[model samples]
Target: MVRQDIPLPDGPVRTCIGCRRRAAKRELLRVTVGPDRDGRQTVVPDPASSAPGRGAHLHPTRECYDLAVRRKAFTRALRLTGGPSSAPVGDYLDSRHDDDRPHLATD
Candidate 1:
């Protein structure tokens, strides 16, 4: 018996609001916009890429996040009435940055 190479199904590609480039869904982060009980705008991270609301995709980088925030891409993409919280996004990226950093020994 011989094994032959088989092509897998191609996943959907979404454009990043920050970089404005098309990339695989797995290669980007999904953010969803929802309304609170008081009708306040809320941005939620949808890592699974499946949420029951308007979504905006973005690259998982501080630079990209900053660019998106500055351009208000998330609002435009999600047709939101308000902007997303940059602090939470920045903090999330900052934590990831910290995890990638080398720890110093303090004996």
Candidate 2:
């Protein structure tokens, strides 16, 4: 008898609102919109990608983040009440830009 090795099936893919590319879900970060304790709009990271409210996916690149902010992609994707406005999500992304740690290449 001979044993054979087979690669496992690739997981589901998600479209990045920033780069407009289809990539594996794991390679993208999920952002969700919710209300704070005072009911004010708030955006948060959805690490598990299973948040209940509206969600959008973004690549980790700074360029992608800028594109999304410029085009208001997040607001549209999440059907936000208002158009693109720098809020919690934007602030979070901005912080990531200053991160000195190197990112692992997905390709």
Candidate 3:
């Protein structure tokens, strides 16, 4: 049998729009297309996955976010008109991994 035909883990899985890697739904962040100040569509982080509409998944790391923006994956995945603003997602990733991140205590 080919590798492609094999079934993946039995659970909810989503492809990361940024890195394009499939992972468990809980491990990736959910983003929804929302409007910016001028009413233009933009990608917004949906941590709770409560936004109503087509949502795209992404890795929380900044690297993945950059890949998505650079590759225009967000626009293609979300079917956004024009180039959607990525500032919201960028800001969220930045804030989520600030200096306040807890360091592991080594024995």
Candidate 4:
């Protein structure tokens, strides 16, 4: 009793730690808490999505990123203590030109 109406699924689904919205893995960016050169745990962007350890997903826009920071979502999602720095993720998003706004379609 298989229904053929189910549309083809996208890739893996992940929730934006910021906006808390579910989107395909390809549509979101992955970040993880990793040790920096100083040996301190910091939230870093995994653009290639190949980093080890647990990872958190987020939209690559300042809005979502800011929302996550406002709500302390990173600490909870990454089980971080002492407020690990998230500047890396912020910088990565800044370097990218695609804000990924919900609407305002360009194409």
2 versus 4: better lDDT goes to: 4
Give the C-alpha miss distance for residue 76 in model 3, angstroms.
0.6
Q: List the residue pairs that clash in candidate 1.
A: none
Highest TM-score: give the candidate number: 3
Q: Candidate 3 overall Cα lDDT vs. reference?
A: 0.89
Over 4 Å off in model 1, which ranges?
A: 1-10, 34-39
Candidate 2 — what's its lDDT?
0.75
lDDT of each: 0.76, 0.75, 0.89, 0.87
Q: Write the per-residue lDDT of candidate 2 for residues 19-86, one digit (tens) a residue.
A: 89877889988988876667777666676778896788888677887898888788788888775443
Q: lDDT score of model 1?
A: 0.76
Error of 2 at 62 (Å): 1.9
Provide the clashing-pair count of each candidate structure. 0, 0, 0, 0
lDDT of 2 at 59: 87
Ranking by TM-score: 3, 4, 1, 2
Model 1 Cα lDDT, one tens digit per residue, 1-107: 52356332379878888988777878888888755556677665677877887788888888888899889887788886656554555676788789999999999
Identify the runs in model 2 with alpha carbons over 4 angstroms from their true place: 1-9, 36-38, 84-86, 94-107
Poorest 10 consecutive residues of model 2 by lDDT?
Answer: 1-10
